[model samples]
Target: MSSIDFSEALDCLKKAQSVLISCHVRPDGDSLGSAAGMAQMLGSQGISAEIILPSELPDRYAFLFEQARPRVVTDDWRRAQLRGFDTVVIVDTSVRAQLEPQYDFLKSCNLPVLVIDHHLESENIGTVELLDPSASAVGLMVAELGEVWPAELSAGGAKALFTAIASDTGWFRFPNADSRTYCQAWRLLQAGVRPTEVYRSLYMRDSVGKIRLLGRALGSLELFCEGRLACMSLLKEDFRQSRAAQTETEGLINESLRIGSVIAAVMLTEDENDSIRVNFRSKRQINVARIAERFGGGGHELAAGAQLAGSIEQAKEKIVSAIREEFSRSGEPGGE
Candidate 1:
């Protein structure tokens, strides 16, 4: 990654009258909230800002959009606003590979571009990349970047910041989260964010499809290397029968670790087009993100993902082997 001083990047930001914000493909809460929160902060400072979601916003976040109502840049054809923006900010994505088709065009823009992320693998996705993998959420960091100071978060801004931190940490339950995360969440709450409201925004409903998806996921699960490793795969037909959206496959990999002794587990799912996506989760003894990063993806040490070609069965085998190797290298799967 190239050198970037946020204090120096601050100059480009404060001077720009028009700013456009974006996040990586298949954006999660931290990216979405950071992009929108940055826009809101800029607007508060009397700067004209636009926020765009490169992919369709995930359904779980619909409540946040309804509540904040930030303008999404995708629909507005205003050429001047589009062309006039002097700064472009991308958040949560650490590398170009995560941004997909949008990264090249955005990177080509002659204007100032900044990236704020908390992923360890960022090899510089922008002219200025402010990365703090230790951070709980990009939204928490963006508040600092915006000079909002946790002490000054508005109700809307507080909600955004809180949601970003809470959702990404899996409600303070993720292994990546530490005392700093709770402290930050407390700070956000003091700024007027409601914990219950934000929690509801994250996980309010359970559709019949999601239940079916869960059943299908549990039914297809298999163990390997004794109980040290496990794997599961969801096919297009399984999703269709379950009435589940492809997105519903979230958290399937964690089922492996639920057994309390398994070091790692992987869930492979084939989307409608036959493309396979894999989610990997590891507990106390393994590093799943290390494995995921090898396959061109990254997340927390205990959790990560990768995409593969051909079939879910192929993806399952590959992931299962990776986990088995990770465990075996640790001196023979120590227990049952």
Candidate 2:
């Protein structure tokens, strides 16, 4: 993939008087943090910036957006506001399908579209793109951009950016976290971001319902591919019984990977439209992103996800089979 120069992206942002920043559906910490931090950074430069998300902001991330929470664009009135902006910055994700609700509206807009992301595979959906898979998170790329640009980041922006990087890198435990990631983290700390505060806000503050949901998810865990792969499914009933929102399923897939023998983990949840949302995580060596791409989804090597057009059972069978085949080809044997 061709990489867009950071300077070019900075120039594009400087030219725009107002920019609308957005991210994929079921917004994650990386997306939310990057969008919020970008908005804050742009605002500091005297540019009118706003963050519009396709889904509700998760409760855990509400603090990062307390100064100015992102607006959810689910209706025409909200969609109409897009016309007022001269630039649209799509952060964290570059997939059109992931944008949801806002995908069609963004396509209809005549303004310049700028994509800032760190995904492995990206759709050619933006007029100006800045994609670097080497970066730990889109927030780190944004932090780098800020360093090169004239605008100064506020304390809130630093915290938001820190959350983006920390969450995406699994708090520096993931393989994606390199020296540059640590350097960016140090830079953010210097910019007035409190590591302890951000860490507690993102991870330590779990709700009772969320804990119940996790219990349900863990109870459903099953092993496949000679214990190399761990799989779990959470049905609609799980959400209702646990009184937990779908967003609470955020970190459940990783829990499966904690098993020492499990090189890969998959979580399938029943979503709206009778489809299944699948999240894939790998401990090492496996390229889950390729599997996700084959299923029309995309992400990093160890972490990726896809939304399949089937029920939870069908999704589990198909995905498990795929993973088994992949493991077999890689010299591992056995499946269940």
Candidate 3:
């Protein structure tokens, strides 16, 4: 976590005339919500801020961009346009690898970077950082930053921040949603964010293809480590037959955790490039982030992801071996 004062980061932003904001590749709700919320907050101060995404925005999250539209980079030329901004604010991730192709551009731009994130094992790539791995979500931190500005959050900003905190903590159902998380959420509610409206927008609008894809994923569920570990895989063929977009795979891994005996879960997805995208989730006994780090990825203790080059079967073998080692090292049930 960064020791930089929250006020100091806000002061840096207060000095900027125009700012460019971004988040990690394959951004989830926390990343996108943080970016959107931050952009709205900066706009309230009369600072020009635009969001640039490394990948295409998922269809489900398109609502967030209506008020705070982002420019999704499609090529080298588009990426270059991110330069020349007065300041850069990176939210939800600080790792160079997570920043991808943007990291190269940022190196040459020589702009002062401010990182606001809540994740373990982050890299030092910020001029000022307000990181709190203990915090439930970066959106929470961003909301608190608004409090320091002593500005009442606009309805749009409040909704975006609400999405950030709710999504990261699984709509306040996950264990991470403590009193602080609820308090921040209540404040957003007071700011005119209707919980039912937001929930319908985020969860009740799944496509038919996504439902079929979920079925196939569950059909592939396999138990290992004496049923304490559950793993599922989805091949390109599965996506083809189901006609599901890749983004629909989000949250599918957590389905296995519903089983009483399962303490850990892994979801292996074959991307278009034939490389495997692995997502890990744990109920508490396992530190899935350490497992992801072994494969050159990092995230929270309970949830993490890694990309592996190889056929899905090959990726499965390597991941299973790693999970076995982690379970053994942790000396948990099914370790032997």
Candidate 4:
């Protein structure tokens, strides 16, 4: 729970004529949904709001904003537009490094930054931050803000927010999903969001290339710590062979944790820069966020990620060793 008052954020929003909404790099459903929903909410109040993503929007979520797609800032000219806003709203992430393309521009801009997020660890980047680690997702927090502000959500906004909440909470299966989460879902449904339609669009629309990529990822699975830890790798060649983009790897890590014997799962993917992107997921008590922070990344407790500056083999060795040490210190069954 952040000590910052939500009223202060509302006051800032009330005075602003224009707003720029952004999220972390490699934006996920929650990030995109929150941004799009927030933009619509602000627009309903006659405020000009635009979203700037650090990278291209993944194909799956592009439907959330059919007519008003967010601008993906790639070069300096597009990035420079961030300075034109009266207020900036950072959603789903507060980590500075996560805002790569706009980081320098945002730092130089003499504007108020309002952060709305649900992560446990956050950098102090916003003048007014509404952060609740207990919330299932940032969309939940945004919904609560809508109630506080008495903002009327359009049908599209409701659908986008539902996508945000559903994606981040694993469709209400994650531990963070609570009574309030369901209540908000109900509210969004009342506002004309069709859950089945959203679910079909999100889960049932995978392509053949994504399935091939999943096969390659599963083929690379390896077990350690006597089956308590499962690790998988997706090489740069995997993408080429499968004709799959990196975004297709989104849910692969969780698949490794499905085995009955595995307590923790790690997905190591070779990035274009030759670095390894590490994604972590745990079933029970492991705090993967702490593990990610040790490697200069941060996320939630059960689900987290980090980028390692090394070969995939080196990253695997280091991360496996760290997981082993964690198990030993915690007196878990896998400790040797």
Best-fitting candidate, scored by lDDT: 4
Report the CA-based lDDT of candidate 3 relative to the real structure: 0.88
> lDDT per model, in order?
0.72, 0.88, 0.88, 0.89
Instruction: Tell me how far the alpha carbon of residue 5 in candidate 2 is from the true structure, in angstroms, after superposition.
Output: 2.7
Best by TM-score: 4
**After superposing candidate 2, which stretches have Cα over 4 Å from the reference?**
1-4, 78-80, 332-336
Steric clashes per prediction? 0, 0, 0, 0
Taking the tens digit of each residue's C-alpha lDDT, what string does model 4 give over 99-165? 9878778877878999998898888889888888888889888887887887989999999999999
Model 3 agreement with the true structure over 109-155: per-residue lDDT tens digits = 88889999889987889988988888889999998888877655789
Could you tell me how far off, in angstroms, the CA of residue 294 lies in candidate 4 after the best superposition? 1.3
Off by over 4 Å in 1: 1-6, 67-81, 146-152, 332-336
Residue 108 miss distance in model 1 (angstroms): 2.6
Residue-level lDDT for 43 in candidate 2? 93
**If scored against the real structure, what TM-score would every candidate get?**
0.89, 0.95, 0.95, 0.96
